[model samples]
Target chain A: MGESILSGTVFAAGISVGPAILPGIFPLAPLLAFNPFTEPVGVIHYMIVGAVMFTAGVVCMALKRNALGVLMGIELVLNGANINFIAFSSPYLRGDGAPTLGLDGQLIALFVILLAAAEAAVALAITLNFYNNHATVDIDRADDLKG
Target chain B: MTGTIRMDSIFTSVLLHLPAPTAPVVAAVDWHSVLFLLFAGLACGFAIAVVAAENVVRMALYLVFSLAATAGLFFLAGADFLGAMQLMIYVGGTLVLLVFGVMLTAQAPLVSIKPSASDRALAGIAGAALLAVLLAAAVSVDAWRKPGVGEIPSPTATPLGMALVGVRVDDPPAGAPLTGRSGYMLPFEIVSVHLLVVLVGAAYLARAKRRKTPRAIDVLASSDPPSQGAVLAAAVPAVRTTSGAGGKSALLGGGH
Candidate 1:
């Protein structure tokens, strides 16, 4: 009886470990289960991409001392948000009977793009003025107002 | 031993249960997902590149590619007008403005100001946290995870134009609770006025200022030890002198 119980426990462990080890050997195996290339793309995929871009933009904004780099970061952040908006608006990407933003999403994205352009223009003007006065675009050195 | 035999049998059973890698299935590939993957890869890759790049010009270039890929994504999502506007305004206009800014301020010392290690680490942590939260939120909704029906809606450019002129030309989506769709004419006018104000304000802020006395920067540069700022300040007078001559010629030309 003791031997049978030990054998059963060992069998169970083997069964559990086999699948885990197989994935390690064939890394793409697990990824292929979802098979994005074969299946249709969804809003979730766009959201993931937007999330990555947004993160990168935030990091760029935080890490760059150059004023123009910060401005670029702002652009990336805006584009990321625009992607989410477009995805939400897309009728093709909606689930069965799912409510979509329809034209409103596209309109909002258009406004965002326009505003981003305007913001960039104003921001560039500000950066140029700062550079003209201080002869440096390093934002850290813009300490004249600091008490 | 009996234990070893049992383990071997279990492994065999597990392998049998696992589906064998059959011949490549000639299934119909979804071109939409392929294009989406391509554009998403380009957009995300270049966005990360923009963050990782050290040179200002390279960052701007990466930004252009990233924004262009995002435009492609907008097109894929059926926002054709938005995509065109993105290409024209974002990739064409704003990026050109950005590149000009980079060139104007591309002094040797300012081109690549690497953040301190501590700042980078802190920002990395914060960005990672934010991304985790966003991704969690994105995938948390079961409805959002459902595969799309992949039906291409009709072109919206005409309806969108009509809507801008205070008319809802297109029918609302099925099951939407809203009864009457409002026109966007008011917001459109507001944005137009806003753009005009921004244009005037930007022009005013960026206009050249002719200072009678030495500017604070020049004063500081002259007082401080010899550095890039002092060198730049020394060059500024030469530029001003040349510009003065050019301005006189322009006035002469205008008189003709």
Candidate 2:
């Protein structure tokens, strides 16, 4: 458990630097301007960042054999989508008047969060049942479902 | 100290870029952004840590931090109700179930499950590629690069709450009002029911095994004995029981 907490702190520190580091990789990053901050915060930039995070989550989901790992991946994907939704709703990145999903985007993100919780509960229960029967959490052993 | 400019006004005035006379009511402070960054950073970081950690309980701990951060982000984003729901439901309720499951499944020998190095390598490669592609797509969209339509709009909690109840409180500037803006009453109701079913299902799954505990004679006469985690405490000399922080045996379902 200590290892997990350590990793969480490390990963958060990494992600915290994302907004600061991203501009270096994308030269055109400065051209757009939606941010209300003294700096240039653009919708494209936010969306792009969200997409990266989402993509990372998908890969994590696909590769993890542990049920918990898979759940973590789902979280990453949800967070990525959330970043996009918020970026869309933010006035700092978009111009004075543009089409937006508006409150609907935020609402959708909220629903996604709530449902994610429900999904976690159901998944955790199923995982426990699997362990009870098989004495392990290896998803590979669940191949009986293929039959 | 006398020259101290209020932090909120300094930010609002500079960010708004409007002359004092012409500027709309610029809040001395927008507490939202300050709080938003704090939570967003916490949630995203802890989530990543959960992926790297090997210990089940530690992973659960990280999950708790991540969810808490996400809840804070929700509030900062002006979804106060959603944020509160996130705290009460996901962090407090569902996560507790997850922890219980973790406790049940973590047998004496299998608490910290580490992934093989090869698997980690493959996942890292795939994750990197996916991140690259998504980042490229995000940068390609030109419209998203400009200031949004709702930029600097008034705080939205009331309108959002009313909208959830079936109202379109804010009119779009210089455009025909939106159509089919039905509030989220239906989805809200559905979520409540979904939660109820999940609660019942989790309870049933976690119920104590109905099969009777092995009879006392079963250990020496018929059944393998239960591990002495509880009984061993009183049986062993007190001086020998503790192995301190580095002791994995302490975590082997031992009450101590």
Indicate which candidate wins on DockQ. 1
Model 1 C-alpha lDDT per residue in residues B1-256, reported as the tens digit of each score:
3335565556655766653354754445567887999999999999999998989999999999999999999888888988899999999999999999999889787889898889988988998899988987787666667678787877889988988888988778766668657888988889999999999999977765455677555554222222333333443433222444444433433332
- What is candidate 1's local distance difference test score? 0.79
Q: Which fraction of the native contacts appears in each prediction?
A: 0.72, 0.33
Candidate 1: what is its chain A TM-score?
A: 0.76
Candidate 1 clash pair list: none
Q: Give the TM-score of candidate 2.
A: 0.65
lDDT of each: 0.79, 0.60
Q: What's each prediction's TM-score? A: 0.75, 0.65
lDDT of 1 at B208: 57
* First chain TM-score for all predictions: 0.76, 0.69
Worst 10 residues of 1 chain B by lDDT: B221-230
